[model samples]
Target: MRTTILLLLAVLPLTLMAQRWHITGFGGLSNYQGDLQEKRITTNQANGAFGLGVQYDLNPKLSLRGGLVYGKLSGDDKKNTDSFLVARNLNFTSPLLEGHILAEYRFFDLDNYRFTPYVFAGLGIFGFEPYTFDTTGQKYYLQPLGTEGQGLSIYPDRKPYKRVQVALPFGAGLKFRLNEMVTLGYEIGWRKTFTDYIDDVSTTYVDPAALLAERGPKAVELSYRGGELKDGNPNYPADGTVRGGSKVKDWYYFQGITVGVRLGSGSGPFSGGGGGKRSRQTDCPRNVF
Candidate 1:
């Protein structure tokens, strides 16, 4: 009984230490796909992104991770070659902040291989507020302006959309073990969002008179920008004119390199202990050698 108690005490700390955890830092470029950007993925306006996270190894092939990432997204109608888009004449930029929890699966064992390709899928919540600068360089946020008649008494169906929304994150990456203490990798992840308003242009246009009366002049000015463009449509569309595609939701993605450091010195069950030495027996020591 005494020996068993002593063994339990001695092994508990080592067992806890053997649980592998990593602190990770990531830096990369982020881009978006929305009404303004017709392409599925483009680097035309990619912006800087970075994140910090913690990960735990569930076994040789699985890991669970959680982290926060911040990035910027921007799009412009003038940059598009499509004449219809050019005539629409809209542009926006927003800062994206996301918090996510993901499960990762690796193709190779970390203990035996120096490199591996991995995939991850998980859930996240993100926040964003789209804004644009007028001809005079005055910046205006678009949501509260109710560009599509959101929050208006006349449009009962066009409810105000929240700035924060949920997203599904999934992607693949390659990882290289720098050493037992450090690791390096590159990952590309896409966030599938539930809302189409990330770019602040969804659904049809509202009546300019009503928008002006309710949200004021700035709202009307920013809500429909085609008139501001040279050779663009001088007249704003009538109420219910299609402003954006509401059927397809917006998507954002991040691609970058990651660096991780192991949290403790104790080796996991399969990793084997240091110095190629056999593990000491767990039974209580008979006496000091």
Candidate 2:
């Protein structure tokens, strides 16, 4: 009995030192630049973002984490010069408040390497706003005008628009345990947004002149001159002969990648200590976005 008591005492400190729950926080710089559909227009911008969250180890092989993230995404405008000559030079920015829940599985746990690799996927929701400027030095909230003969319209009365959309986030990462309580790691992830109008442009139409007036023309011309604009014909061919009938569609998509770090405690059920053990370890859950 005395020998058993001594053994329990020796194991108590190690058990207490084991990590069961961990809190992680990190900040980093990110940038996104890409085209929408076949539009030749390009968007490029850089910004900083951060995340804070907590993780609970259900066992040595599996864990769950939940956290909040804040960030911004901006891009260049698309230029439309078909039947409707709407030359839009716009930029988009969003203050995203997101929450994510992820399950992680450590695949490679070696003593000398002390590195664990994992994959995770989650969902997020965010707020978005897009701003536009024309060649005539006008600034407006609405998309560029799509009118015939006349130039871009300037609509100042249009109320600011905001929308919430679901986001799919998934990626793989590597974590090197610097110590029992501290982990240094890097992650690469992709976020896919559900909204197709992140650029603030969609299947909407406005008078070019009115839009230009609201948004000063800085050499930008929003004019419609195609068969579709003239007689409401959607079957208008792209022949140079067709005149005075074109409309602009405000549709776009958002995609980006992020890198960050995580920190947490070392006490866990499967840290080879006294906590309950898990039967049949499993890999990380797949992305649900």
Best by TM-score: 1
How would you encode candidate 1's per-residue C-alpha lDDT over 202-275 as one tens digit per residue? Answer: 89988988888888989888888888877777798999889899999999999999998887654444455553
Please report, in order, the local distance difference test score of every candidate based on alpha carbons. Answer: 0.86, 0.48
Residues 158-274 of candidate 2: C-alpha lDDT, one tens digit per residue: 433346667676767777655445666776556665544555433334543354455544312322212223344333222233222224322222223333232323324344433
Q: Please list the residue runs of candidate 2 whose C-alpha ends up more than 4 Å from where it truly belongs after superposition.
A: 1-18, 32-44, 78-87, 110-113, 132-162, 209-268, 273-289
Cα distance off (Å), candidate 2, residue 98:
1.8
Error of 1 at 137 (Å): 1.2
Error of 2 at 286 (Å): 28
Candidate 1: regions farther than 4 A off:
1-19, 266-269, 274-289
Report per-prediction Cα RMSD to one decimal: 6.5, 10.2
Candidate 1 residue pairs that clash = none
